[model samples]
Target: MFRFDWKMTLFVLLLLPVLIRLGYWQLEREAEKRDLQQLYEERQSSAPLPISGVDWSDKDIGWSRIQAEGYYETEYNFLLDNRIQSGQVGYEVLTPFRTDYGVLLINRGWIAAGPRREILPSIETPEDKAVIEATIYIPDGELMMFGEETLSGEQWPKRIQQVHLARMSEALGEKLIPARLRLSAGSAGELSIDWQTVNMQPEVHRGYAIQWFLMAAALVVLFVFFSFRRKEKPNE
Candidate 1:
């Protein structure tokens, strides 16, 4: 018969559930990542469509190739801070492009920050009209303070930590299209293009899940080996 040490059993009981739970959690994450990659792949394979042709009701329009013709609001620009590219700290230049349909925030590209925090880089935006080919990125709704903004106060090429649609709208004195367009290569005003669609692959999550499950299995094996006892012969 097998005998279990109370303390060891209790330890296994406590730690096993945590290990199993972590494995399941990683599996769930893997599933979610797979779904996102599938969606991204489906959208990327299609042809570019006019920005105005898309239906607003479709919420999963990310990576949707799009084209738009408009003049950039060169006077007002935004610098998205803490954007890193090629292991160098920089900012993503977000310029307002006024289209006939609506005003859209165009992610031009990454620009290196200067030696000092206060000294901002100079971005020369052509005042002339431009037709840009880009991808539409509809970000998820964020929980924000009722009236708070992430902008760097009243300043040209304002630095922002986050993309708050309502805050940007308030700053621009008008409502924006709620979507940030990433300019394609060779397009007007486009700079360094280093976009990472999926930061972590599903395989990574799957590997983590396997590790957690293996830990749980090892714990079970050790518990079983320690708790087992050989039958003893009867004594006279």
Candidate 2:
């Protein structure tokens, strides 16, 4: 006859729920990623929309292709730190563009980092007023700060670790639009624009969910096998 191991049963009961929960969580993440990918594809396929005063209120305007006529404010610029391209350290140059409604931050492009951390790179902004085409990229959520949130400097080209629109607006002494425009190809002052909307694919999340579920199943099988196996006969 087989004997029940209450300790093993309790351990499995405790761990099974956690594993199952993790699997379900991954599945939820997969669904979210799938929806986001679909939305991105749909937006990219549509015609470019003009940036107007009425359209500014739409929160879902991010990632939408837009066109605007503005003059770039070359005096004050921001260098986004820790940006890497082709295995070389660089910074994404963000310049403010004064449009009819308000000033909008435009991510002009990327530039290679200088020899030392203290040395800043030279960024040339387009001089004349021009019509620009770009994709709107609204910064979402708060950044995880390891130390101070703002950069330590009061200079022309400020170096920043993360984008904080409110803080930046205050520093620049002008109210800027809450989003950034990623310069399109052939646009003035454009650089490498390999932007990724979704970091992980839905299939990857589904695979992780399957792994967690398999782990749970394996635990159940081992528990059953160990609990029911016949004990070895003792030598007389």
lDDT of each: 0.84, 0.84
Per-prediction TM-score: 0.83, 0.88
Q: Write the per-residue lDDT of candidate 1 for residues 1-236, one digit (tens) a residue.
A: 68857898999999999999999998998888788777767977888889789765587677788888999998898888888898999899998899899898899999999999999999978788888888886543333536655564668889887787788888889988878788888888887778655667788989999999999999999888877856567972
Tens-digit lDDT track for model 2 on 1-236? Answer: 66799999999999999999999999999998787777777987888887784377788877888888989998888999988888999999898988887888888778899999999998888889998888887443445878756644678799888888888888788898877778887887787777766667789889999999999999999998998888878872
What residue pairs are clashing in model 2? Answer: none
Model 1, global lDDT: 0.84
TM-score of 1: 0.83
